[model samples]
Target: MDRYEGFREFVHGRQQALMRSAYLLTGDASQAEDLLQTVLMRTARHWHRLAGDGNPEAYVRRALINEHVSWRRRLRRRPETPTAHPPDRGRDRGDESLHRLALQEALMRLTPRQRAVLVLRYYEDRSVEETAALLGCSAGTVKSQTSHALGRLRVLAPELADLLNAVDPQEVPR
Candidate 1:
């Protein structure tokens, strides 16, 4: 087998899924592409070992999450100022797309850690323990972060209130 055959196949099969996670984590398409590329490059260096371990996807997922957090920290140290004008939403997208855009905006406003918890718990459908494990935090911390993140999301995008209810009625604070 070609030395890169396995790695190539793995990337082809999982790239889309990983990209979706990347986009969710970074909240920007270009940033997500960059994040995924950086993680994949790192993963490629360890592909032989990771492939033998039989769970490269998990490794890549963890790396993606960690790299995202690192990028957030570095950006915080030298944050860019936003323009006075918000980017136009571009014509009427109707309610569903508008809500999605609103949710994405609110998510971007959250702390990287909080956003990671929400993505793992809600988007990835991971359990509390799983999220905690991925986040290197206790289950209680995961639960609390989830609650706080949800509450913050409500404040950041009140229009998403009803959609948030659909996410987990018990979790969204009044």
Candidate 2:
């Protein structure tokens, strides 16, 4: 009973953070929900073993990330979001919502690893060392990946690049 109670508390405390990270990784709301559910289920199976650990959250997070990568590799294809032409440059209505959608679409176009790097480094506002640790890579790899992700974003969506430049880094939502 105590173990179950503790697990419940852990879920209540961490569900939002896990969901946010899952959404960033999957890029689709439904898929994100599924991903979180799967991770939670798997974690529950090892709850007894993990619960005694000082930082079970880290272990669960590592599982979440590894599972996400495994799923992508098994599928052998990127997510298949329907693409639509962006609004004409000449007729810019300057709609913030539209810009946000465009930015999201651009993000979805990125490879999973690139998207993960951006989400951890920018959206989550984790330090390079932290991001590298989470991704199981060196700090130098994180730096290079961040640089390349930014460049890819620029090329994939110039308008989004402008939007990114216009917003304060702090204003960027997690």
Give the top-scoring candidate (lDDT). 1
| lDDT (tens digit, per residue) of candidate 2 on 21-116 | 888788677888899889888888878788888787877677777888888887777765655975453435568867766777788777777788
Query: Which 10 residues in a row give candidate 1 its minimum summed lDDT?
Result: 165-174
Candidate 2 segments exceeding 4 Å error: 1-5, 77-94, 166-174
Q: Write one digit per residue (lDDT tens) for candidate 1, span 1-174.
A: 555559999999999999999999998899999999999999998887898888888889889999999998898899798999988757458898888889998999999899989999999999989888877889999989988998899899999878777876665344
* True lDDT of residue 20, candidate 2: 88
Choose the strongest candidate by TM-score.
1
TM-score per candidate: 0.88, 0.78
lDDT of 2 at 52: 85
Poorest lDDT segment (10 consecutive residues) of candidate 2: 165-174
* Model 1 CA deviation exceeding 4 Å by range: 1-5, 81-91, 169-174
Q: What are the clashing pairs of model 2?
A: none
